[model samples]
Target: MAEILLPLLVLCPLAASLLVFLSAGRMGARAIGTVACAGVGISAVASIILSVMLLSGPVAGGLQVTLWPWMRVAGLSADIAFTLDRISMVMVLVVTIVGLLIHVYAAGYMRDDPGIARFFGCMTLFVAAMLVLVLASDLLCLFIGWEGVGLCSYLLIGFWYDDPANTAAARKAFYMTRMGDVALLCGLLLLACATGSLRIGTVLASVADGRLPASGVNVAAAFILVGALAKSAQIPFQAWLPDAMAGPTPTSALIHAATMVAAGVYLIARVHDLFAMAAPVMALTAVLGALTLLMGACTALVQSDLKRILAWSTISQLGYMFLVLGCGVWQAALFHLMTHAFFKALLFLTAGAVIMRAGHEQDIFRLGGLRRAMPGLTAAFVAGASALAGLPLVTAGFYSKEMILSGVWHVHFGLAREWTLSGHPLWGIALLGAFLTALYIFRCVFIVFCGKAGTRAAGRTSRLMGIPLVCLSVLSLFGGVIEMPDTLPSLHLFSALLNPGTPLSHADEPVWLVLAGALAPLAGLGVAWVLWGRPSPVMREIPGQAGVIRPARTGRGMDVLYDRVFVQPFRLLAWLTRLDIPGHAITGTGRLTRAANAGILGARAGLLEMLAIRATGTARWAGHLPGLFQNGRVRWYAAWIAGGLCAGLAMAVLS
Candidate 1:
């Protein structure tokens, strides 16, 4: 029964997307919403049932179901397979249950949209793709889902195509992610070449057996890290996410919560075995994670836009996941991933509701004193904000974050005889991030919800919108009790469920470490209270704050840097490539013409002119061939890829 149902986890929503897309204008908004919700809702329910089944069965090894044979050639074979292990179980539950809630909310949020059906279709498709990405046992097969989510992101982010900003954001995300995806593909190919199989277990076995050289392991792991970093929107790749806010709020929520941005962390966690052998790469990952964690927290602090703030917050939280991952605590990385999903989703949805009521106002400063106008929303927002700040003892984020902090403190990476990657330094970065996380989130809360009502909010919260917020809020508040540090009762339910026999808390962990982790958020809350709790105009207009917000909001000019450094240069190269051949041919013709006029070919000048014209025309026709890949049409590019794949396969079979 479990085998029969596993594929449906991805298929349900995929089918819904297809059905809704095919029906198109034939279906009304309500019908479309029903279809979308039913697809994800069924998957969510099945995920719970499967979780029950998994709890009773072998969790470490998991149950596998092969849906179909994908390919076989060149000493390699792949299958369209799914695995329902503890890690995947967590991911499935988060993707489906949280996805279902987001879909339901979106149905209400986008009820009046002319493109509601299209929106739901793309969203359902995205859920299906995310499910595939998590469940696949083969790395090559996983790429299908990986690319699936990227394409869906491009579609959903640009769903409101009339808005130039929205389309640009979508393109930016697509191009930036592709940069990482290319590296990811290279890594997968390297693995396949070395191990003769792309199965997750097989590749790991190859690494353990020393079939793959140390250098190969390091290079492959580095490529995978690049991909994950870009996908999760870490420092260098972090700018795309804030701009991603041009999409609708539900899109933002889904992407931030689980479907898209978190994909990178999940991938790294999945391939931890291989990463473990690449110690230098692992240290690099940890260092990068710390840098990203600090950068995201600082950038998020100065953002005025409501959704952008959350976007940057997502980047920062994901940084913690990577930090633990780099520190070789993949389980802890995943633990935080689950809790972060609950509260972050809660926050995004609550922000959506507030934005809708406030006449689409998104600037936190503009939305003054909303706490009085919409107390329910204010309460919901506060719950999420508290979780975001990881308020000690009460919030799910606190436990998950505590697990992460403890993990960071316990990391034992030795860089050299006298030097090592100490947990204390990274721990310090994470603790500082904690402080900023609380301060910034609470700052938004106190500013937007506490001050006198300046923005006149309209309409009431629909049941659809209110329900997800309420459910997620409850989870955000009480979800942490399942896991606690030694200083507390030492609940280990979450750790046990994730990996049985794994200790809930580190043995003999210093007491002050946990105390410091607890105090950081409290200190942040205190600072936020001192700054914005009283709701004075003077407090709102803090001197020298603009200087910080300006650079931070612009991602410290990373966007401009990208435009100047990468984008402009790429555009120039593509432009040159497109004309390089024909331009040279024409220039040669001009040179010849001048020479002919100089009497070198005076008697045959007419024939020379004819020859020059013919040459120019022929060169123009030939020039486009060199630049076909440079043209920005996706369909044409895909066709090129298809043709290349066919040729490669033919050569392989023939050889």
Candidate 2:
């Protein structure tokens, strides 16, 4: 049953995407949505059944389904396979279930749009690809799905092709993520070279048994870490996500909350065994995650656009997941991933409805007193905000966050005596991020929903939209009860479910840490109420000091840095190519070739003349060989590839 269901999970959506493309606008929006929803519904059901079966069996049980032999090359045996263990089980549930809800919400959100068919096609394809990412047992096979989602995201982000900015944003996202993808492919090759296979289990086992040397482990881990960093939008790679909001709101929700950004954390958690052995890489991850957390939280505090606020918040929350994963508490990372999915989805969807009702206006300052115009949306927004803020006892975010905070408190990382890091400072950074998370998110909520009707609004959310909000709201508030701390019931159900035999024990939490973690959110709420809950003018001060808001809003100039370092040089090379200099050089070579042939034919005096003509012809022919590969239009693309190869070689030589 599990075997049949496992393959069916990916096939269902794949078939539906094909149907959507085949239908080709002949079917109405209703029919297209029905097809997409039904496909996702089947997948969600399959996920439930497969999860039940995995849990019901022995402690180490999982379902590994192999479809066929993918390849056999130079001692490598790779298969197209899927694995449903506890970690992937959690990922499968989130991608399928939350994805299904988002699809349903999108059906209503996009009903009036003319490109509904194309939208559903790319969206369903996105879900299918994400499922492939989480479930694959082979690392190389997972890259297929990894690139698959990148393609779908590009298509969906530019779904409204009429807008030039939308297409540019799509291109920007594609180019930035491609950098990480290249590094990831390199890491995969490194592992394959070390272990002679790309199977996840084989790689982990080999690395654990010391089959790979220590330096090999460190290099592989560093490469994979860079990949995850760009994908998850941490620190240096955080610029693209805010611009990614050029897509539709539902697209924003799906990508930010349930799927693409979460892929990085899932990949890290999936291969945590490798990270545990590389202490320096782990410390680097922790430091970067903490930096990104503070950066994202601070940026969100100053944004006026509602969607951009959520966008920055996603960056911050993912930082927490990265933080916990770096600290060797991947289960806690995943727990927050789940809870973050629920609340983040809820918040994005509700914000979409709010924007729709307020005449497509997204600025929270321009939208006020929605508490009167749309009461239900106000309540839903509050529910999501409470969870995002991690307000005590009832909200799921608090428990998951506390789980992470606890893990951070106990973690220690260092490679040698000269380079050591305690969890205390990073934990402090995380707690500060937590406080800013509460302050910024609730600031949006209060300004948008608490004031008197400042902007006109009409047309409440439809039943289709409301249903997902209601379901997610409940999940956002109650999901963390399944995993409690030592002071509580000591419920290790979440951890226990992941690794059946090793339930974590945590009875000795420090008083100050526990007390501070619980209070940070509440204190932030109090500050927000003092600042935003009343009729006060908007403040421009960033966290810790007075600073320029524009820089924070633009991800603290990371974009400018990248543009200077990466984009400008490439643009210069492109402009030089578009000038057609290569084409002219090729034409000159053709002229030289013809002249040399003429000289050769004309040479008939003696052996000396013949030898000179032959020598000249050989030189001309060799020069002409260079022109054979010049395509004339934009050699920039070819140059990029050649440059990449050169860089790779340089790196090899340097190493």
Candidate 3:
């Protein structure tokens, strides 16, 4: 039953996408939206059922259902299999539930667009691909889904093909992720070569049992880490994600925030043993995550665009997840992944409503005083923003983020025997990141929702858009209750369901760390209040100075550096290949061919004229000989006739 049902989770959306695509020209927007929503909704239901069953049943090794024999070679074999474990169950639920909600929201969001059917089609396919990726039992199968998501992202990101900027953004995202995909593929190949199989379970088991060497695991893990970093939009590869905001807002919600950006974290968590085997790589992951967290937080602080602000926030949040994973807390990282998905999706969806209400204006400075007109949206935005800001005890982000910080604190202090006052450097950096997260998110909220109404009139939101916001807003606020820290005895539902054996108790946590965690967001909120919450002359004038905000707006010169170093050089090479090399070769070949043809034609004409002249000369000479033979007309004729007759007779006698 699980076997048949699990594949349906992947197949339903795929079939819906196909149906939508095939009937695109024939169907209206309403019909297309129905098909897309129904498909994802059904998958969400199935995911719920699977989650229930897996939770009730024995889920250690998981319930593996082999659909077919995918491949077979000398010492290698793989199957199109699905694994329903605790981790996968959480991922699938988040994907399908949030995916279905976004699809519903998009139905209203994109109703007026002519290309709504195409948008829904690509969106549905994207969900299916992610489902396939999460449920896949083998590395090869996962890679197929991996590339599938990449393809779908490109299609959806550039759905408005008329816009060159959107297309460019899509291409940038595709190429950047492809670089990581290549690394992932290399890692997969290395794992296959080392273990003689591409089955993820087999590889993990081998690594756990010490069947594979540490060196090989380290190399493979390093390659996979690069791939994960690129996919997750961490650090250098992160420039594409902010630009990806060129896509529709719903796209920003579903792919960029909720599912796709988190795939790298999922991949790392999924193959954690490989990382654990390589101590150096694990440490590097921690450092990278810490660096990205600070970078994202700092950049997000000064962004005026609402979506770009959230985009940078996502990068920063993902860094926290990676930081936890690197610190050897996979479950904590996943917990953060779940909570972040709920709130971030809510945030983006609400931003979409805000943008629509503002007549498609995305600049936070321009969007002001909508709290009264659209109370529901304003409340929803506050909920998401509060969660994002990690406001005290009420929001989901606070709990999840605290867990990661706790984990980091433990790893840092637990390792050293000395009870020094100096905490881990990452802990301090992470604390600062938390402060910035609170400050930036609230800064946008206060600027956009709290101030005087700007020029744009507030547009009405449809129930389709309003309902998802309401639902997600509720989740964002109360979702933290599920994974309450061990200090609280009543609620450990998420921890128990996800990690039954290992209880994360806070009693042993350092008191100073807890104090910092509790105070960081408050401090940030206080700072933001002073900066944006209260009307100030400085706030008004700061927007005009390009020098003051340009660095943060441009991702602190990372984009400039990338364009100068990577994009420009690549463009030059591409120009040479596309135009210079081919153009010159074609022109040179045409010139040489024309010159040779001209010489050949000239030679032929000269030779023909010379032959004609020679023929005329021979004719003239023959005529002169006949004249010489006949001095007088009669005498010449008689001599020629006699000579001809004598020659004929002599020839006949000789014969």
Candidate 4:
């Protein structure tokens, strides 16, 4: 049953994509929408059933289904196989369930667009690729899905290819992720070379049993980490995501919340053993993740565009997941990944509803008093924002975030010592990120929904859009109950279900960490209310002043620095290649070749003319000598013959 269902989860979306694509010209929008929704709908149902079977049945060692031999070479082989385990089950559920909701929302969101069928086809294909990625049994198989999602993202992001900016954003995403894909490929090769196989199980077993060397593991882990960072949009690679808002709102929700960006975190979680072996790389990951969290949180604080704000928040949240993975808390990172999927998708969809109603104006400063115009959307927004802000006691984000912070605190403090509030630098960074997350999210919420009505009037949201929002809103609010902290023991169902062998333990956690986590969101909310809840002169003056808002909006000069360092240099190289190298050097080669050819031709012609002139001169000289000799004097002939004989005798004597 598991084997059949596992393949069906991936194949359903592929079949739907093919159907929509083949029938695109003939099918009406209704039929296209029905096919698209049904495709993902069936996949989601299959994922649910698969999850239930994995949970209830004996799957201590994950269930693997091999479809065929995908590829083989000397000393290398990878199968077209799927693995159904705890981690993959979690990822599949999030992708299918959240992806289905986004698809449903997109049907309403893109209904009027002429390219609805194309959009659904790409969306379903993206879902299929992600399913393959999560369930893949080997690096080779995973890479196929990895590149598949990258291609799908490019297609979907540039879905409206009429706009130059949209095409540019899509290209940017494709190129950037490709850079990481190269590194990921290198990592895969290193693993295959070292472990003699690309299978996930084989590599993990090699690492576990000390068959592979530590140095090889470190190098491979480092390379794979770069790929993860780039795919996840951390620090240097993060500039593409905020600009990725050029896509449709549903595209934003899908990429940011559930699919492409999440791939990075999933990759790290999947390869946890390699990272654990390379402690130095894990430490580096921790530092980078901490820095990225701060970077994204600060940037989100000043963003004016609603979608861009969510985009930055996605980067920041992903940073938190990386930080946890760095801390050797794979379970916690995945926990946040799951809960973050719920709230983040809810947030983006809610933002989509607002964008639809407000005449497509995304500037939060321009939006106001939407609390009354659309109550359902407003409620959904609050739920998602609360979860994102990590509000205490109720929101899902809090539990996941709390677990991460606690993990960080525990790791930073020695195992011999109890958890302490003091001397832990990472704790401060994580808390600061949480504080900014709460402040920025609520600031946008208040400014957009709590102020006076602006120019755009609120329009009615469709039932399709409202349904996903309500469902995700519920999940955002109550999803945390599954993985409640050990501080509250009764709601530990998530830990039990996902990781029954390792229960949530509170013995090492101090009371202060939980207290600090609970207070951070409140403090942030207080600051936001004071600044933006009322029409303060400072808030009014802040938006208009470039000096105040530029740093945060520009991602604190990270973009500027990257442009100067990477973008400018690359652009110059491209310009040189296009104009200088080809235009000057290559074109100059043609001129040089022509000049050499003409010079050789002229030299050859001159030499032949000179020889001809010499030949004519010799012939004329011979003719004159013959005329002289033919003077017809017997005496002269005799003298000449005697002189010739004498000269010949003298020459022979001398010789």
Best by TM-score: 1
Query: Which lDDT values do the candidates have, in the order given?
Result: 0.89, 0.89, 0.87, 0.86
List TM-scores for all candidates, in order. 0.88, 0.87, 0.85, 0.86
lDDT of 4 by residue, 526-577 (tens): 8898888876523732454477468678554666777798889999999887
Between candidates 1 and 3, the one scoring higher on lDDT is 1
Better of 1 and 4 by lDDT: 1
Clashes of each: 0, 1, 0, 1
Judged by whole-model lDDT over C-alpha atoms, candidate 1 comes out at 0.89
Ranking by TM-score: 1, 2, 4, 3
Give lDDT: candidate 3, residue 558.
71
Q: Which residue runs of candidate 1 sit more than 4 Å off their true CA positions?
A: 416-418, 535-538, 545-548, 575-655
lDDT of 1 at 17: 99
List the candidate 2 regions with Cα displacement exceeding 4 Å: 417-419, 535-547, 554-556, 575-655
- Where does candidate 1 clash, by residue pair? none
Candidate 2, 12-75: lDDT as tens digits: 9888988998896799988998999999889999999999999888788789899999999996
| TM-score, predicted candidate 3 vs. hidden true structure | 0.85
Which is the better candidate, 2 or 3, if ranked by TM-score? Answer: 2
Tens-digit lDDT track of model 3 for 340-401: 99899999999998888788888887878878777888899899999988886889988888
Worst 10 residues of 3 by lDDT: 413-422
Q: Which 10 consecutive positions of candidate 2 have the poorest summed lDDT?
A: 537-546
